[model samples]
Target: MWIKASGRAAMLGLKKKILEQLRGAVEQAQREGALPPGSLPDVEVERPQNPGHGDLATSLPLRAARAFRVSPMAIAEAIASRLPALEELEPVTVAPPGFINFTLRTRWLQEQVHHILSQGEAYGDLELGAGQRVLVEFVSVNPTGPVHVGHVRGAVLGSTLARVLEAAGYRVTREYYVNDSGSQMEVFYRSVWIRYQQVLGRDVEMPPGGYMGTYVVDLAREIHGERGDHFLRLDETEAIREIGEVALERMVQAIREDLGLIGVDFHVWFRERDLYQDSAYQKAMSMIRNGGYVAEREGARWFVSTALGEDKDNVLVRSSGAPTYFASDIAYHYDKFLTRRFERAINIWGADHQGHVSRVKAAVVALGVDPRLLDVIIVQMVTLKRGGEVVRASKRTGELVTLRELVEEVGRDACRYFFSARSADAQMEFDLDLAKRESQENPVYYIQYAHARIAGILRNAREKGLQSEEGDVSLLNTGEEMDLIRKLVLLPELVETVSATLEPHHLAYYALEVATAFHWFYDHCRVIGEDPADQDLVRARLKLVEACRIVLARTLHLMGMTAPQRM
Candidate 1:
């Protein structure tokens, strides 16, 4: 049920209202002997795919038919006949195969414009989460280099989901897990040390599989400028350790700045090394071992994943006494679920990490936590294109395109919109030319232009001394007006749907639909006109346009995009 928490009682949206009515009508039918008394199935209400069919439809009768031992059509008719009259809806109708459809009255939708105006920025806010704690961990890219295009998709998804959850009344904590305790950081540290030697005029060959990006050399140069030959005085081991720590700090700072270019910020920057220092790793391993999920094999400790129905067992610690990345993940989740006690933890990882999902869940269960508390969203890679040709590397650095560069070229709004326009499971191609285009073909521009157009109308009204607050929403009776109002009232329900599904791409698509409806309404109606006698109609239309602006702006804000007042 799509319910929102109000002051003392739950505020029911249109979908929830329909569901309640359907359940009540079913009970009334059973009491009146129209249908057999039996257990009722879960009733669900959904928007009809065909607008002409009705606004919302349900299959409750079909679901209950077997239990009641009645024809679905007869059950539907019985339920429809017993339904109480709802002022917000037109007459309920029954369709073939036992579908009950409900359509909102045109006048009801028109009145919602005033309701939206009264709510203002609070129109779409929902309390569905009821103050539960949720940790959204994403973009935990190895702090080896700048944030590349491959990582930005997950970054945007995580940040947008965090925002949507917050608007739905969840206490959300955004986090980035810094993989500083792994072999990758070891390579990054050595790569920086070698680069420092090279910059100081030492002829040295880089290690096998060293970081070859120019950013590493730049890091070496910056270090040399600040502390010239300072590391040369220390022993090589000590010098490497110090240089690696400094390099890691610098890399993480760079990543933070790059993500900030697209409006992503994290409440927590968790270090993998902390798991060892704080004994979280030891605690997690102890719990797993006590649960008999750990075994000794091949001179190393192995996680007995096969016992948990996995195809193969996994090594927890190598023979050399070093923990694997999988071990680090188990410790991290222990901290998330047991130490911090978040009700739910959402991890957004790149597609490359898809294989680790089931194992992580298995590990969580080994630690005595419910596996359902963890959600892993794998975001596929992003392909950059320019003029329909694939763009592989940056022209300036000759490496993967950085998030900063993308934001600089296309602006932050375009970067966020395009990244969020696609589902996390699908690979998306971000077109540079289309993103920067000023025309309607660009969804970012088209949506923002609708808000800008509304702004212009309101500005014109104010200049003419026409007060929209005094307008009668009842005067809004045109088909276009009702259609626009219909779109406007969908925001609250959309918030609940996206919150429940944890899919933020729906918000992006909904924003576009709202923009399309506003554009259609504007083409057919005028909010500001020349004749004095048409002023009443003008005022009413202005109120509706203002409602459109509110909903559109709220949608953009939730997606972390700007609602430009002017093109």
Candidate 2:
């Protein structure tokens, strides 16, 4: 059941047979003593970054020259003569320093453009993931308040990464961890109480370190419920807990809505309160202590994290016998790895927790879990900018922007695109005005416009009674068309590389490359109203254009971006 040498139908539109031919030829050279046996390292083949250097380039000759005691130029000459032929990759010339550059045959590239049109939406997906299970946890903000813009970047990042992973053949679970413990929850309760009193028309000021947002005011009014007047005289602790519970639920609902607007939907909503109620942390602590991984110091229980590369011991329980936030994390991670047995667990955290990474890893290692099975991605800070001024994240009592507010201003698409457009390890600025623009200056709109244009062309082609069958592949031989073809053909490599690297930004960059190629082809090549002799060429060109559109559509889709058929 071997596949045929179909023109442009080569697997994934690559010259697979030709690559094998080249490999065989190089080996033949070694066998014939034209070059020393095993002189070259593994046939290192690659597409040159700069087109001027030719199609494919390899440094094998130079690498083996010193070992073989022969000049690199001579070694390259021997290999070139014995080299097997390839379809598009014409082994053109050996440059200085043992670089073998290549030139792709125009006919082969033209055929690729045709192949792309014929393939349509099926063009780029190569099924590389083969359906493995991958769980992604992100934007685990406490339910004390609405999600601030500070949390938006990671939300977009994790959701997009999940989409990318799914496209690459992994079944992805997107989860959000709700922190309902620690002093933060207490702060939340207090804020709700203050707001409840305010709603009841009390003259009391908010606590010294408490939220001043109008959201708290809304929560208080909801809780007051005609007892609005009685809330002012109610006991502080009772009022705080009541307000905290109801307010926490409302805030989580708002966050879900905010995420929903941006196309981010989570598979699980895990609460930290559930962990404590189930006694998971107590069991984890007891197991670690009995397992001899915990010790007592200064009347406090400390985990022996130093054995797993941590600098010092971390307190598992304070002298007051209450566990710290780290204790909850240990239990949560244990639940994920030990109880769930999810193959692996992935956490997308914010820059604020940068210091916790090492300790978390150490704890996982100490708990007898393979540290390699844990993946932690920290999203750097994002500064919201409007009118050339830095907008701060309102620290409960200060002026700031919530994620929902930002999404309302620009849009979900712009927010997701802007955040996931760069390396997650670096900080970025969210230009509010620029993202809201309808112009090409707005990248999401720019990419969407390209998709829309192609759709328009196709729709009108049908209405105008144009014969739109995929025309002859031989008609598309121009460099611009071939360039577009080559870029489209590399979709599999792009997806696989980005998935393996865990970098969704690479897919964003690929979208831009495909868009640039299509735009260039669109400007230079006409799609209709030509002479009869050029009729087939028009069809072929349109087909190529359609293929580009499909790729642009799907790549953006994988990124969870809307590829609009019209702006």
Candidate achieving the largest lDDT: 1
* Cα lDDT over the full model 2: 0.77
Kindly state the number of residue pairs that clash in model 1.
Answer: 0
Per-candidate Cα RMSD to the true structure, in Å, reads 2.5, 3.1
Per-residue lDDT of candidate 2, residues 298-416 (tens digit)? 99989888866778989988898878889899999887877666776789999989999999998887678898888999889888888688876657464568877888888878877
Number of the predicted model whose TM-score against the real structure is largest = 1
lDDT of each: 0.88, 0.77
Model 1: residue 119 alpha-carbon error in angstroms = 1.8
Clashing residue pairs in candidate 1 (N, C-alpha, C atoms within 3 angstroms)? none
CA shift of 292, model 2, Å:
2.5
List candidate 1 segments past 4 Å from native.
1-12, 66-69, 393-398
**Model 1 RMSD vs true structure:** 2.5
The true-versus-predicted C-alpha distance at residue 525 of model 1, in Å, is 0.9
